[model samples]
Target chain A: DAGITQSPRYKITETGRQVTLMCHQTWSHSYMFWYRQDLGHGLRLIYYSAAADITDKGEVPDGYVVSRSKTENFPLTLESATRSQTSVYFCASSPVPYEQYFGPGTRLTVT
Target chain B: DQQVKQNSPSLSVQEGRISILNCDYTNSMFDYFLWYKKYPAEGPTFLISISSIKDKNEDGRFTVFLNKSAKHLSLHIVPSQPGDSAVYFCAASLKSGNTPLVFGKGTRLSVIA
Candidate 1:
Protein backbone atom coordinates (compact mmCIF):
# COMPACT_ATOMS: atom_id res chain seq x y z
CA ASP A 1 0.00 0.00 0.00
CA ALA A 2 1.05 3.60 -0.47
CA GLY A 3 0.13 4.67 3.06
CA ILE A 4 1.48 3.83 6.48
CA THR A 5 0.94 0.30 7.82
CA GLN A 6 1.34 -1.30 11.27
CA SER A 7 1.82 -4.95 12.00
CA PRO A 8 0.38 -7.15 14.78
CA ARG A 9 -2.77 -5.03 14.89
CA TYR A 10 -3.37 -6.53 18.33
CA LYS A 11 -0.98 -8.05 20.87
CA ILE A 12 -0.89 -9.50 24.38
CA THR A 13 2.37 -10.02 26.22
CA GLU A 14 3.50 -10.96 29.72
CA THR A 15 5.03 -8.54 32.22
CA GLY A 16 8.65 -9.52 31.79
CA ARG A 17 8.57 -10.14 28.07
CA GLN A 18 9.80 -7.79 25.39
CA VAL A 19 7.49 -6.70 22.60
CA THR A 20 8.12 -4.79 19.43
CA LEU A 21 5.60 -2.99 17.23
CA MET A 22 6.54 -2.30 13.65
CA CYS A 23 5.58 0.63 11.44
CA HIS A 24 6.30 1.10 7.78
CA GLN A 25 5.34 3.77 5.31
CA THR A 26 5.61 3.71 1.55
CA TRP A 27 5.49 7.47 1.18
CA SER A 28 9.02 7.73 2.59
CA HIS A 29 8.10 10.63 4.81
CA SER A 30 10.95 12.32 6.62
CA TYR A 31 9.17 12.34 9.95
CA MET A 32 7.72 9.31 11.81
CA PHE A 33 6.19 9.24 15.27
CA TRP A 34 4.90 6.80 17.86
CA TYR A 35 2.08 7.68 20.23
CA ARG A 36 0.13 5.81 22.88
CA GLN A 37 -3.53 6.61 23.50
CA ASP A 38 -5.11 5.85 26.84
CA LEU A 39 -8.28 6.76 28.65
CA GLY A 40 -8.15 10.36 29.95
CA HIS A 41 -5.01 10.88 27.87
CA GLY A 42 -5.70 11.48 24.22
CA LEU A 43 -2.31 10.83 22.64
CA ARG A 44 1.14 11.02 24.20
CA LEU A 45 4.14 10.93 21.95
CA ILE A 46 6.65 8.21 22.80
CA TYR A 47 9.29 8.90 20.21
CA TYR A 48 9.84 10.56 16.84
CA SER A 49 12.33 10.21 14.06
CA ALA A 50 13.35 13.03 11.79
CA ALA A 51 15.16 10.88 9.28
CA ALA A 52 16.99 7.59 8.96
CA ASP A 53 19.23 7.04 12.00
CA ILE A 54 17.96 10.21 13.70
CA THR A 55 15.48 9.69 16.55
CA ASP A 56 14.47 11.61 19.65
CA LYS A 57 12.24 11.18 22.69
CA GLY A 58 8.83 12.71 23.09
CA GLU A 59 6.52 13.47 26.04
CA VAL A 60 6.41 9.88 27.36
CA PRO A 61 9.56 8.08 26.31
CA ASP A 62 10.32 6.28 29.53
CA GLY A 63 10.42 2.46 29.33
CA TYR A 64 9.98 2.61 25.56
CA VAL A 65 12.70 2.53 22.93
CA VAL A 66 12.48 3.46 19.24
CA SER A 67 14.84 3.15 16.32
CA ARG A 68 14.67 4.08 12.65
CA SER A 69 17.27 2.21 10.65
CA LYS A 70 15.65 3.18 7.34
CA THR A 71 13.44 5.99 6.26
CA GLU A 72 10.44 3.72 5.77
CA ASN A 73 10.58 1.83 9.05
CA PHE A 74 10.21 3.00 12.64
CA PRO A 75 9.83 0.39 15.32
CA LEU A 76 9.00 0.81 19.01
CA THR A 77 10.25 -1.68 21.57
CA LEU A 78 9.27 -2.24 25.14
CA GLU A 79 12.21 -3.85 26.94
CA SER A 80 10.01 -5.27 29.64
CA ALA A 81 6.31 -4.80 29.33
CA THR A 82 4.39 -3.44 32.27
CA ARG A 83 0.70 -3.61 33.04
CA SER A 84 0.44 0.16 32.92
CA GLN A 85 1.75 0.08 29.35
CA THR A 86 -1.48 -1.41 28.09
CA SER A 87 -2.88 1.03 25.59
CA VAL A 88 -3.53 1.55 21.91
CA TYR A 89 -0.35 2.48 20.04
CA PHE A 90 -0.46 4.64 16.94
CA CYS A 91 2.14 5.37 14.28
CA ALA A 92 2.13 8.43 12.12
CA SER A 93 4.18 9.82 9.25
CA SER A 94 4.45 13.33 7.88
CA PRO A 95 6.38 15.46 5.43
CA VAL A 96 7.89 18.45 7.16
CA PRO A 97 5.17 20.77 8.48
CA TYR A 98 2.29 19.01 6.75
CA GLU A 99 -0.51 17.10 8.41
CA GLN A 100 0.26 13.61 9.65
CA TYR A 101 -1.06 10.40 8.12
CA PHE A 102 -1.76 7.82 10.79
CA GLY A 103 -1.66 4.07 10.54
CA PRO A 104 -4.54 1.85 11.63
CA GLY A 105 -2.76 1.41 15.02
CA THR A 106 -1.70 -1.55 17.16
CA ARG A 107 -3.50 -2.44 20.36
CA LEU A 108 -1.07 -3.81 22.97
CA THR A 109 -2.13 -5.54 26.11
CA VAL A 110 0.34 -6.17 28.91
CA THR A 111 -0.70 -8.84 31.32
CA ASP B 1 1.52 19.61 33.27
CA GLN B 2 -0.57 19.15 30.12
CA GLN B 3 0.19 21.84 27.62
CA VAL B 4 -2.99 21.19 25.67
CA LYS B 5 -6.32 20.61 27.37
CA GLN B 6 -9.79 19.79 26.06
CA ASN B 7 -12.07 20.34 29.01
CA SER B 8 -15.15 18.75 27.49
CA PRO B 9 -15.17 14.97 27.52
CA SER B 10 -18.07 14.68 25.11
CA LEU B 11 -20.61 16.77 23.27
CA SER B 12 -24.04 16.14 21.83
CA VAL B 13 -25.25 18.04 18.79
CA GLN B 14 -28.23 17.67 16.54
CA GLU B 15 -27.65 17.21 12.90
CA GLY B 16 -27.76 20.42 10.86
CA ARG B 17 -26.66 22.40 13.89
CA ILE B 18 -23.33 23.94 14.65
CA SER B 19 -20.81 21.97 16.71
CA ILE B 20 -18.24 23.89 18.65
CA LEU B 21 -15.24 22.28 20.40
CA ASN B 22 -12.90 24.28 22.54
CA CYS B 23 -9.23 23.80 23.41
CA ASP B 24 -6.83 25.59 25.74
CA TYR B 25 -3.08 25.53 26.06
CA THR B 26 -0.66 26.71 28.72
CA ASN B 27 2.38 27.04 26.51
CA SER B 28 2.84 30.42 24.89
CA MET B 29 5.56 29.13 22.60
CA PHE B 30 3.18 27.01 20.57
CA ASP B 31 2.92 28.54 17.11
CA TYR B 32 0.76 26.01 15.28
CA PHE B 33 -2.43 24.25 16.25
CA LEU B 34 -4.29 21.35 14.64
CA TRP B 35 -7.46 19.34 15.07
CA TYR B 36 -7.81 15.62 14.34
CA LYS B 37 -10.80 13.29 14.22
CA LYS B 38 -10.75 9.60 15.13
CA TYR B 39 -13.22 6.78 14.99
CA PRO B 40 -13.67 4.02 17.56
CA ALA B 41 -10.79 1.82 16.41
CA GLU B 42 -8.83 4.05 14.08
CA GLY B 43 -5.99 6.45 14.51
CA PRO B 44 -6.77 10.14 14.33
CA THR B 45 -7.07 11.79 10.97
CA PHE B 46 -6.13 15.39 10.44
CA LEU B 47 -9.18 17.63 10.11
CA ILE B 48 -8.00 21.22 10.09
CA SER B 49 -5.16 23.43 11.27
CA ILE B 50 -4.43 27.08 12.05
CA SER B 51 -1.14 28.90 12.35
CA SER B 52 -0.29 31.46 15.01
CA ILE B 53 -0.05 34.25 12.48
CA LYS B 54 -3.78 34.05 11.70
CA ASP B 55 -6.71 34.24 14.08
CA LYS B 56 -8.98 32.05 11.97
CA ASN B 57 -8.77 29.53 9.20
CA GLU B 58 -11.64 27.94 7.33
CA ASP B 59 -12.04 25.00 5.01
CA GLY B 60 -15.42 24.18 3.63
CA ARG B 61 -17.78 23.82 6.59
CA PHE B 62 -15.00 23.62 9.15
CA THR B 63 -13.41 26.65 10.78
CA VAL B 64 -10.66 26.99 13.39
CA PHE B 65 -10.26 30.11 15.47
CA LEU B 66 -7.11 30.83 17.43
CA ASN B 67 -6.98 33.36 20.26
CA LYS B 68 -3.31 33.65 21.06
CA SER B 69 -3.75 36.15 23.83
CA ALA B 70 -6.07 33.82 25.72
CA LYS B 71 -4.15 30.73 24.69
CA HIS B 72 -7.36 29.26 23.38
CA LEU B 73 -8.61 27.79 20.14
CA SER B 74 -11.85 26.32 18.86
CA LEU B 75 -13.10 24.19 16.00
CA HIS B 76 -16.50 24.96 14.51
CA ILE B 77 -18.46 22.60 12.34
CA VAL B 78 -21.46 24.15 10.68
CA PRO B 79 -24.44 22.07 9.72
CA SER B 80 -22.84 19.07 11.29
CA GLN B 81 -23.82 15.70 9.89
CA PRO B 82 -24.19 12.34 11.57
CA GLY B 83 -21.09 11.17 9.81
CA ASP B 84 -19.13 13.81 11.63
CA SER B 85 -19.59 12.07 14.97
CA ALA B 86 -16.22 11.00 16.31
CA VAL B 87 -13.54 11.73 18.91
CA TYR B 88 -11.77 14.99 18.17
CA PHE B 89 -8.26 15.73 19.44
CA CYS B 90 -6.48 19.07 19.59
CA ALA B 91 -2.71 19.32 19.18
CA ALA B 92 -0.07 22.04 19.27
CA SER B 93 3.47 22.36 18.04
CA LEU B 94 6.21 24.90 18.66
CA LYS B 95 7.06 25.16 14.99
CA SER B 96 7.69 22.02 12.99
CA GLY B 97 10.82 19.96 12.40
CA ASN B 98 11.79 17.86 15.41
CA THR B 99 9.36 19.39 17.88
CA PRO B 100 6.89 16.65 18.68
CA LEU B 101 3.24 17.65 19.08
CA VAL B 102 1.50 17.89 22.42
CA PHE B 103 -2.06 16.57 22.28
CA GLY B 104 -5.05 17.16 24.48
CA LYS B 105 -7.59 14.67 25.69
CA GLY B 106 -10.09 14.12 22.90
CA THR B 107 -13.70 15.27 22.89
CA ARG B 108 -16.23 12.75 21.73
CA LEU B 109 -18.83 14.34 19.45
CA SER B 110 -22.15 12.66 18.91
CA VAL B 111 -24.19 14.12 16.08
CA ILE B 112 -27.75 12.91 16.41
CA ALA B 113 -30.04 12.86 13.44
Candidate 2:
Protein backbone atom coordinates (compact mmCIF):
# COMPACT_ATOMS: atom_id res chain seq x y z
CA ASP A 1 0.00 0.00 0.00
CA ALA A 2 1.15 3.51 -0.76
CA GLY A 3 -0.57 5.09 2.25
CA ILE A 4 0.16 5.02 5.95
CA THR A 5 0.33 1.69 7.82
CA GLN A 6 0.33 0.48 11.43
CA SER A 7 2.02 -2.64 12.69
CA PRO A 8 0.67 -5.25 15.15
CA ARG A 9 -3.00 -4.65 14.42
CA TYR A 10 -3.82 -6.03 17.87
CA LYS A 11 -1.81 -6.26 21.08
CA ILE A 12 -2.24 -7.60 24.59
CA THR A 13 0.06 -6.71 27.42
CA GLU A 14 0.15 -6.72 31.20
CA THR A 15 -0.03 -3.59 33.25
CA GLY A 16 3.33 -1.96 34.01
CA ARG A 17 4.74 -3.42 30.83
CA GLN A 18 5.81 -1.42 27.86
CA VAL A 19 4.50 -1.56 24.28
CA THR A 20 5.23 0.41 21.20
CA LEU A 21 2.99 0.95 18.19
CA MET A 22 4.55 1.75 14.87
CA CYS A 23 3.25 4.10 12.19
CA HIS A 24 4.84 4.42 8.80
CA GLN A 25 3.94 6.74 6.00
CA THR A 26 5.33 6.52 2.52
CA TRP A 27 4.16 9.96 1.58
CA SER A 28 7.04 11.61 3.46
CA HIS A 29 4.71 14.07 5.07
CA SER A 30 6.26 16.55 7.47
CA TYR A 31 3.60 16.13 10.14
CA MET A 32 2.56 12.99 12.06
CA PHE A 33 0.20 12.40 14.96
CA TRP A 34 -0.82 9.78 17.53
CA TYR A 35 -4.42 9.58 18.69
CA ARG A 36 -6.29 7.17 20.92
CA GLN A 37 -10.00 6.46 20.52
CA ASP A 38 -12.12 5.71 23.56
CA LEU A 39 -15.87 5.17 23.92
CA GLY A 40 -17.05 8.66 24.89
CA HIS A 41 -13.81 10.52 24.44
CA GLY A 42 -13.70 10.25 20.68
CA LEU A 43 -10.17 10.52 19.31
CA ARG A 44 -7.85 12.31 21.72
CA LEU A 45 -4.45 13.27 20.54
CA ILE A 46 -1.53 11.88 22.53
CA TYR A 47 1.29 13.54 20.66
CA TYR A 48 2.32 15.02 17.36
CA SER A 49 5.55 15.66 15.53
CA ALA A 50 6.51 18.38 13.13
CA ALA A 51 9.26 17.23 10.81
CA ALA A 52 11.77 14.74 12.21
CA ASP A 53 13.19 16.38 15.28
CA ILE A 54 10.34 18.36 16.77
CA THR A 55 7.48 16.91 18.87
CA ASP A 56 4.75 18.20 21.14
CA LYS A 57 2.24 16.87 23.67
CA GLY A 58 -1.49 16.73 23.10
CA GLU A 59 -4.63 16.40 25.25
CA VAL A 60 -3.63 13.06 26.81
CA PRO A 61 0.12 12.73 26.85
CA ASP A 62 0.91 11.75 30.40
CA GLY A 63 1.24 7.99 29.83
CA TYR A 64 2.36 7.92 26.24
CA VAL A 65 5.65 8.76 24.57
CA VAL A 66 6.28 9.46 20.89
CA SER A 67 9.33 10.13 18.76
CA ARG A 68 9.88 11.00 15.13
CA SER A 69 13.55 10.53 14.42
CA LYS A 70 12.71 10.10 10.76
CA THR A 71 10.16 11.89 8.68
CA GLU A 72 8.58 8.70 7.31
CA ASN A 73 8.21 6.93 10.65
CA PHE A 74 6.62 7.92 13.94
CA PRO A 75 6.44 5.46 16.83
CA LEU A 76 4.33 5.68 19.98
CA THR A 77 5.47 3.94 23.15
CA LEU A 78 3.54 3.23 26.28
CA GLU A 79 5.91 3.01 29.21
CA SER A 80 4.60 1.17 32.25
CA ALA A 81 1.20 0.83 30.66
CA THR A 82 -1.92 0.97 32.79
CA ARG A 83 -5.35 -0.57 32.40
CA SER A 84 -6.81 2.84 31.61
CA GLN A 85 -4.52 2.99 28.62
CA THR A 86 -6.46 0.34 26.78
CA SER A 87 -7.92 1.80 23.61
CA VAL A 88 -7.71 1.85 19.83
CA TYR A 89 -4.68 3.85 18.73
CA PHE A 90 -4.49 5.53 15.36
CA CYS A 91 -1.63 7.18 13.53
CA ALA A 92 -2.15 9.94 11.03
CA SER A 93 -0.06 12.05 8.72
CA SER A 94 -0.58 15.18 6.68
CA PRO A 95 1.45 17.51 4.60
CA VAL A 96 -0.83 20.18 5.98
CA PRO A 97 -3.41 20.26 8.74
CA TYR A 98 -6.33 20.51 6.29
CA GLU A 99 -6.46 16.81 5.36
CA GLN A 100 -5.05 13.87 7.31
CA TYR A 101 -4.51 10.26 6.33
CA PHE A 102 -4.85 7.55 8.93
CA GLY A 103 -3.56 4.04 9.39
CA PRO A 104 -5.68 0.94 10.12
CA GLY A 105 -5.24 1.42 13.89
CA THR A 106 -3.84 -0.73 16.69
CA ARG A 107 -6.08 -2.19 19.34
CA LEU A 108 -4.12 -2.26 22.59
CA THR A 109 -5.38 -3.96 25.71
CA VAL A 110 -3.66 -3.67 29.07
CA THR A 111 -4.76 -6.23 31.58
CA ASP B 1 -13.35 20.59 28.53
CA GLN B 2 -13.75 18.87 25.17
CA GLN B 3 -13.08 21.29 22.37
CA VAL B 4 -15.13 19.34 19.87
CA LYS B 5 -18.35 17.59 20.84
CA GLN B 6 -20.84 15.32 19.10
CA ASN B 7 -23.68 14.98 21.61
CA SER B 8 -25.53 12.24 19.74
CA PRO B 9 -23.97 8.87 20.30
CA SER B 10 -25.71 7.33 17.32
CA LEU B 11 -28.19 8.02 14.57
CA SER B 12 -30.48 5.75 12.62
CA VAL B 13 -31.76 6.66 9.20
CA GLN B 14 -33.79 4.83 6.60
CA GLU B 15 -32.26 4.19 3.25
CA GLY B 16 -32.94 6.83 0.62
CA ARG B 17 -33.43 9.44 3.30
CA ILE B 18 -31.31 12.24 4.58
CA SER B 19 -28.87 11.78 7.45
CA ILE B 20 -27.61 14.71 9.43
CA LEU B 21 -24.73 14.62 11.89
CA ASN B 22 -23.98 17.63 14.01
CA CYS B 23 -20.78 18.86 15.67
CA ASP B 24 -19.83 21.81 17.87
CA TYR B 25 -16.55 23.33 18.93
CA THR B 26 -15.64 25.57 21.81
CA ASN B 27 -12.45 26.92 20.34
CA SER B 28 -12.98 29.92 18.13
CA MET B 29 -9.39 29.62 16.97
CA PHE B 30 -10.19 26.53 14.98
CA ASP B 31 -10.16 27.58 11.36
CA TYR B 32 -10.82 24.30 9.60
CA PHE B 33 -13.40 21.56 10.10
CA LEU B 34 -13.53 18.09 8.59
CA TRP B 35 -15.57 14.92 8.63
CA TYR B 36 -14.23 11.39 8.62
CA LYS B 37 -15.82 7.94 8.28
CA LYS B 38 -14.64 4.75 9.94
CA TYR B 39 -15.69 1.16 9.51
CA PRO B 40 -15.62 -1.54 12.20
CA ALA B 41 -11.89 -2.24 12.06
CA GLU B 42 -10.52 0.53 9.96
CA GLY B 43 -9.01 3.90 10.53
CA PRO B 44 -10.99 7.03 9.80
CA THR B 45 -10.99 8.27 6.20
CA PHE B 46 -11.50 11.87 5.26
CA LEU B 47 -15.00 12.58 3.91
CA ILE B 48 -15.42 16.32 3.44
CA SER B 49 -14.26 19.60 4.90
CA ILE B 50 -15.10 23.31 5.09
CA SER B 51 -12.80 26.20 5.85
CA SER B 52 -13.65 29.05 8.19
CA ILE B 53 -13.74 31.37 5.22
CA LYS B 54 -16.66 29.45 3.75
CA ASP B 55 -19.96 28.37 5.27
CA LYS B 56 -20.64 25.41 3.00
CA ASN B 57 -18.75 22.83 1.03
CA GLU B 58 -20.19 19.97 -1.00
CA ASP B 59 -18.90 16.89 -2.69
CA GLY B 60 -21.31 14.59 -4.46
CA ARG B 61 -23.76 13.12 -1.91
CA PHE B 62 -22.08 14.70 1.09
CA THR B 63 -22.42 18.32 2.12
CA VAL B 64 -20.91 20.13 5.09
CA PHE B 65 -22.48 23.25 6.52
CA LEU B 66 -20.76 25.52 8.96
CA ASN B 67 -22.45 28.09 11.17
CA LYS B 68 -19.65 30.34 12.37
CA SER B 69 -21.89 32.35 14.65
CA ALA B 70 -23.23 29.22 16.34
CA LYS B 71 -19.76 27.72 16.53
CA HIS B 72 -21.30 24.62 15.01
CA LEU B 73 -21.06 22.52 11.86
CA SER B 74 -22.98 19.63 10.32
CA LEU B 75 -22.57 16.92 7.75
CA HIS B 76 -25.56 15.94 5.67
CA ILE B 77 -25.80 12.86 3.55
CA VAL B 78 -28.58 12.92 1.02
CA PRO B 79 -30.42 9.72 0.13
CA SER B 80 -28.34 7.79 2.58
CA GLN B 81 -27.17 4.38 1.53
CA PRO B 82 -26.36 1.24 3.47
CA GLY B 83 -22.74 1.72 2.65
CA ASP B 84 -22.84 4.95 4.59
CA SER B 85 -23.37 3.09 7.83
CA ALA B 86 -20.30 3.75 9.96
CA VAL B 87 -18.88 5.90 12.71
CA TYR B 88 -18.67 9.48 11.57
CA PHE B 89 -16.27 11.88 13.28
CA CYS B 90 -15.94 15.64 13.11
CA ALA B 91 -12.57 17.26 13.56
CA ALA B 92 -11.16 20.76 13.78
CA SER B 93 -7.77 22.43 13.53
CA LEU B 94 -6.21 25.83 13.91
CA LYS B 95 -5.05 25.82 10.31
CA SER B 96 -3.41 23.75 7.59
CA GLY B 97 0.12 23.46 8.86
CA ASN B 98 1.94 21.44 11.49
CA THR B 99 -1.00 21.63 13.87
CA PRO B 100 -2.83 18.47 15.02
CA LEU B 101 -6.57 17.94 14.87
CA VAL B 102 -9.13 17.88 17.66
CA PHE B 103 -11.83 15.29 17.08
CA GLY B 104 -15.34 14.72 18.35
CA LYS B 105 -16.63 11.60 20.06
CA GLY B 106 -18.04 10.41 16.77
CA THR B 107 -21.60 9.44 15.89
CA ARG B 108 -22.45 5.98 14.68
CA LEU B 109 -24.76 6.26 11.70
CA SER B 110 -26.79 3.20 10.79
CA VAL B 111 -28.56 3.30 7.46
CA ILE B 112 -31.32 0.77 7.42
CA ALA B 113 -32.47 -0.68 4.16
lDDT of 2 by residue, B1-113 (tens): 88899999999999999999999999998999999999999999999989999999999999999999999999999989999999999999888453678899999999999
Query: What is the Cα-based lDDT of residue B64 in candidate 2?
Result: 99
Per-model CA lDDT versus the true structure: 0.93, 0.93
Q: TM-scores across all candidates?
A: 0.97, 0.97
Any idea what lDDT model 1 has?
0.93
Model 1, B11-112: lDDT tens digits are 999999999999999999899999999998888999999999999999999999999999999999998999999999999988844376789999999999
Candidate 2, residue B6: Cα displacement in angstroms equals 0.8
User: How high is the lDDT of residue A8 in model 1?
Assistant: 89
- Tell me the tens digit of each residue's lDDT in model 2 across A15-89: 999999999999999889899999988898889887898899989999888888899999999999999999999
TM-score of chain B of each: 0.97, 0.97
> What's the residue-level lDDT of B56 in candidate 1?
99
Question: In model 1, what are the clashing residue pairs, if there are any?
Answer: none
